[model samples]
Target: EDVHIRREVNALYVYAFCLPSCREYLSGSKGEGFLFPWSDLDIMVSKLPPEEISMESFHNDCAYIATTNGCKPGFCKLIQSYAKCDYYSRVEFLQLKQHAGFNVNFDQTIRGPCYSTNFPDGFDCCYALPVHPDSSNVFLRTFKTKFWNGVKLEIMNKNITVMHCVPKGPEKGDDDGHQWLISFSILEQNIVHSLNHVQF
Candidate 1:
């Protein structure tokens, strides 16, 4: 249990110091503090280009609007109101630029929404964009479930802002390239941290 907690703390420290202010997160087994011999790192990067603005900000040609019109539950299609440029449209380009400084050779094959490395101690990196839950009624409805009954209001307020829209995984349809999965990584991390030793 001590080792588990230590691992989580170490990951947070590394990310807080080494990463930029783009809200990069350590996720998967390592972030949950259950590292096994085969465990690999999972990183989620939620940063927009310098020219872009968040959904709550001004809606310009660079803005991506999340719409659930034809997607499955917990997923939405990112529709750009106007295409002034292909910067955000080309997901691969954005991902490559984001990890350029890592100096690691990523595997040629794309794995779901991540760009993975082939080494034994490799990591899976994914790019995402932030979306405020209060910006859409769909998100508000999803959060008003019976599951949140006993949860503290403060925790909800703190974690909900961390919600993100990740690129759709390969398991979905071809049109998935334009789709985004709603992620609650921060909320999940908090819940894991709150678990008792036995529960963990």
Candidate 2:
């Protein structure tokens, strides 16, 4: 019984923001029993839309709908940025403190990795903001698969860990919101690239 519950917590952790120690599982709820099956896939995305999507309307979609056709209402988080430069080039940022209500963290800090200033057209990781609770002016991600539902399973996916704020439009600066950035995995060299200005 104990072993079964452990697996549930770990699986949910992969999809949601949770603390192993803090989460308490119940008999049939979040505590015990198999909410679904066992699938081994780990994907950490920077939260985003279907690519080529912008930040402005992204928040509207989330705020407008409580859930997608196949997603939990509160499990997803948005990651976006409001930079005017070219993706992570010193742009406005979101205040996670104001949105998430509490506070959340990423696997790594979004800045400091020394990317080029004159970025290439593609090859840039989508800059990301933290998942905020307001669902207003935010970036986001959603889980499409549930263990117990549907069929034709294809797990094991990875996404570009969106890194910086890349904006192709006006600069709203900090106060307005840095929720314009979103990112996925860099599986291929097809996202954004550096322009050679920050050469080594």
Candidate 3:
């Protein structure tokens, strides 16, 4: 029990994000498939890049580059860690942790509700789907979408419907002849706080 609680606390510190690269909005634009320009941010404490697999080689290479103009050991460590830890973890970990980055656009006008729909014409969209670092946690963050119609979209990777209610026979691949149907689940109470009590 102690081990489980410790692990949960550690996992809470790990941060993940999908920050937009540009402020420009692509939802209502004339673009066909490109959703928006954004850079996904996912932070995790993990291993180094394969190229820098050995700890010795990484420090040696980075140290040599840094030494050119009176560089310090800490500077070398920063560069080495950034490439080895930051870059590699974000790209590789996501591949294993979440679904592959998708090429899609949420243009409801052209593509309708089918997220798997292909890119129309030559235009393309970039999707950054993040999976929880801790698989044991039942919480999953759906896709982050910004719509032109003021309706934001968050898609859950899990089959469990966070949305209020799924349509009749949603599993058997039935369209129900309706192009658009939206479901929303409302949580009654959301609170975060500390529990303090005297025992023992």
Q: Judge candidate 1 at residue 76 and give its lDDT.
A: 66
Question: lDDT per residue, candidate 1, 30-76, as tens digits?
Answer: 76667588988888877733323234333543356666666677776
Instruction: Point out where model 1 deviates above 4 Å.
Output: 18-21, 48-62, 81-103, 106-108, 136-152, 169-173, 198-200
Which candidate should be chosen as best, given lDDT against the real structure?
1
lDDT of model 2 at position 166: 28
Q: Quick one: RMSD of model 3?
A: 21.7
Q: Is candidate 1 or candidate 2 better by TM-score?
A: 1
Tens digits of per-residue lDDT, candidate 2, 87-133, equal 22223332331233223322222322112122222111223332223
How many backbone clashes are present in model 1? 0
Minimum summed lDDT over a 10-residue window in model 1 is located at 48-57
TM-score of each: 0.69, 0.21, 0.16
Model 3: residues >4 Å from true position, as ranges? 1-42, 45-47, 53-69, 77-200
The clash count for each model shown is 0, 31, 3
Model 3: per-residue Cα lDDT over 63-124, one tens digit each: 11111122222111112333433212222323332243342333322122212223354332
lDDT per prediction? 0.60, 0.28, 0.23
Compared with the true structure, model 3 gives a TM-score of 0.16
